[model samples]
Target: AQSVTQPDARVTVSEGASLQLRCKYSYSATPYLFWYVQYPRQGLQLLLKYYSGDPVVQGVNGFEAEFSKSNSSFHLRKASVHWSDSAVYFCAVSAGNTGNYKYVFGAGTRLKVIA
Candidate 1:
């Protein structure tokens, strides 16, 4: 079985500060990793995803993630954050065959950006 874990339930960062949200996974094989952000009352927005090829994947709004196979981790990073970046971020993993893929989501990390 595949599972994803976000160690921090909540993270606070100052505006314009750098941020890194940790995400770890447990899977026998390399699974598809994704980072999604959810704004208040809004749907989950895809921040970044890593399926293959590059270990680092760029996402929208200056977001990016790096997939570490050895560490079984996919961590999200932003050089600088804004007030709009404050949201609940979720790390998810998709495993199984092409059509039989199953997604396991993390508990999510709520980010609070203060001035």
Candidate 2:
């Protein structure tokens, strides 16, 4: 079984500050990792994803994530965050066995960027 965990329920940062959202997962095998952002009253959008290749993947805007197989962690980072970056971010994991896949999501971290 695979599961995702986001320890931070909410985070507040001043505009232009750097931001990092923590994500951890547990799975028996290699897992597909993803980060999604949901704006107020809007659907979730993919920020980034990792399946293979580089351990670090570039996402939309200035967002990026680093995957650590040893630590079973995938953390999201932004160089500078704007007020528009205020949203709920979710970390998801997908691992399959025998053609049956399991997708699990974290509780989500609500980010509030203050001007």
Candidate 3:
């Protein structure tokens, strides 16, 4: 069984400050990992994903994530954040075969960017 843990339930930062959201996973094998952001009433938007190849993957809105196999972690980072970037961010893991996959999500971390 694969599971994700987002330690922080909420995070607050200055409008232009750098941010890092921690995510840890437990899985038997290396699974597909993803970061999604959800606005107030919108659907989940794919920020980035890591299946294979590069350890670090770039995402939309100047966001990126680095996957560490040994650490069993995939942490999201942003060089600088904007006020609009404040939202609920979720870390998810997908396992099983190509078509038949199951997704496990973390308790989202709500970000509040203040000026």
Candidate 4:
């Protein structure tokens, strides 16, 4: 069975500070990892993803993630975060090869940015 874990339930950071949201996954084979952000009352939006190739991939905004097979992790990072970046961050994993490409999402980590 595949699973996703986000150790932190919530994180508070000062505005303009660097941010790193940890994510870990468990899967037998290569996994399609993704990072998504959900606003208060909006759908989850893709922040970054790692399918294949380069371990590090750039995403929208100043976000980026590095995939580590040995660690079974795909952590998201940002050089500087703004107040608007406050949201619930979710780490998800999907095994496309499996008969059912169902995605398992982590509990979620709420980010609070303060001035």
* Candidate 4 TM-score, true structure as reference: 0.97
Candidate 4 per-residue C-alpha lDDT over 1-100 given as tens digits, one digit per residue, 9 for 90 to 100: 8999999999999999999999999999999999999999899999888889999999998999999999999999999999999999999999977786
The digit string of per-residue lDDT tens for model 2 on 1-115 reads 7889999999999999999999999988889999999998999999999998899999998999999999999999999999999999999998844364767999999999998
TM-score between candidate 1 and the true structure: 0.96
Per-model TM against the reference: 0.96, 0.95, 0.96, 0.97
Which residues of candidate 2, in runs, are more than 4 Å off?
Answer: 96-98
> Candidate 2, 109: how far from true, in Å?
0.2
Scored by CA lDDT, what does every candidate get? 0.94, 0.94, 0.96, 0.94
Q: Give candidate 2's error at residue 7 in angstroms.
A: 0.4
lDDT of 1 by residue, 46-69 (tens): 998888999999999999999999
**Residue 13, candidate 3: C-alpha displacement in angstroms:** 0.4
Q: Which ten residues in a row have the lowest lDDT in candidate 3?
A: 93-102
RMSD of every candidate to native, in Å, equals 1.1, 1.1, 1.3, 0.7
By summed lDDT, which 10 consecutive residues of candidate 2 come out lowest? Answer: 94-103
| Clash pairs (backbone) in predicted model 3 | none
Which run of 10 residues does model 4 get worst, by summed lDDT? 94-103
